[model samples]
Target: MYQRFRSFFLLAGLFLLSACTSAGITVANAPVPFFEGTIERDIVFDEESKQTLDIYIPDRATEERLPVVIFFYGGRWTNGEKGDFAFVGTTLAEQGFVVVIPDYRKYPDVRFPAFVEDGANAVGWVHKNIGDYRGKSETLFLSGHSSGAHIASLLIVDERYLEDGTISAIKGFAGLAGPYSFTPEAEDVKIIFGPPSQYPQMQATTFVDGSEPPILLLYGRDDEIVAPYNLERLRRKIEEKGGQVQAKYYSDVGHIEIIGAMSWIWRYKAPVVDDLALFFRENSDN
Candidate 1:
């Protein structure tokens, strides 16, 4: 029995290290039954083809409205799909929050500000329509992993992507292994937010003025892709601006594992989901 479990975990680790995709993480999560929830897929949040989102609502006898979470998956701003993160939605929904996973235009298809604009558009749609799903828009929390986290954090701090009303509605944000501040050394990445001179504007750290909503930054100490300084720089800026910010670092966890820990199979590796739930609840009025 011990060897069987060890083999399973070893295989799972290999999968996670290779790619942080639904197929990779599902190896462990598929065997466990998901918590009761209603998954509404392919709901269009904008006129654009990729501007669709999925909502996961917990099954409950009471009609009490629940806090809403909009999670964006990371793909280095190049690749990702809303359907690829159903596990994320279902897991958070199980924790008593309505979870929304939105699809945005990716690089090669669109450039900076375009994808960010799509994010704002999605938020606007949620604020106007989430009540019908028993979600309290006023208690909305933004969250994402990797590049997705960059998008979410930028929306909250930049204030230019989202409308004032929509931005004000966000109660908190949680970022996992986000690149809050960094220079794009890769040619493709540079082109994604190009014109060299405007690179600073592309960073979330550029807009921290202390008036933004509370933020929770989660990262893995062993994350080589994003580097731990990204979290520290953002956290330091937010704190220097007198904004509410909290950070949690996991030892022995890497970039992909930080978010992968949210899944049931690898959840024992860290308390990523629990920390997210607590942060959201703490910042919410509902």
Candidate 2:
């Protein structure tokens, strides 16, 4: 029941243009679709470890084992809430996928690996218990923007998140205008992604081994927040390693426009939404 929007294109269009207004934003707005009788519940991902998850399933979706898509919101690994991503549930779920959005530990509270660990563990819970929501646990796809995307990518490539425990593994991935090979220059940037955080090694580019599942990547040509070179590096890493990765660049769109693509079923300006659905559909374990 988050605030809903009527006009899709204009609102998203204007938001994407405002990427320069702050220290790069992670998650944009959270606008949900009109859904009734949908169920919401929480599950413990790691009880002793203080991990939990929020799952959303369609009212009409019960008989079938629907696909699951887990989302991690972006806030420079600092600030974001599960509620901030309410839009993703109705947006992607309308495509017949069960969507899980979890709030992982953020900066100051913890750091890089913590969020990634929490993300991976959340997926673990989704994998094991999603059937209650009639989710096809075997076909969970991972996605996020900016920092959230970074967490999703690292867990897939690094493999350490599962080293400690069991989490339903990811079958596919979609990154929206993410900074996979982010520049390690600026001081503030360096502190956030550099040095002790294993900045160099944590980059998604360095770990895009073809060993991971297939992927779909989207970015905007005018994204002032994350440099285009970062996207280039990520695409190169994935494609060169024999992994399946697709890119959609909106020459005039900004960083936030990519978020609107989540609502593409309604707006339909970008091909990202369909491309993501098709990616999971084609690669689904169902």
Query: Which candidate number has the best lDDT?
Result: 1
RMSD of each: 2.2, 4.8
lDDT of 1 by residue, 106-221 (tens): 99989997888888889999998999999997788999999999999989988778887788889999999999999899999999999889888889989999998889999998
Clash tally for model 2:
3
For the record, the alpha-carbon RMSD of candidate 1 to the native fold, in angstroms, is 2.2
Mind giving the per-residue lDDT tens digits that candidate 2 earns over 1-286? 2344535644554465354423212222323435543647456677766765667777663587887888887778888777656666666777778888887887677755778878877887777788878887677789888888888888777766764333335777888877787766766556666574577677888766787777777788878888888778888888899987777787666666576556532245566667777887887863
Candidates in order, TM-scores: namely 0.93, 0.83
Which pairs of residues collide in model 1? none
Error of 1 at 82 (Å): 1.2
- Give the number of the best model, judged by TM-score: 1
Query: Which residue segments of model 1 deviate by more than 4 Å?
Result: 1-22, 28-33
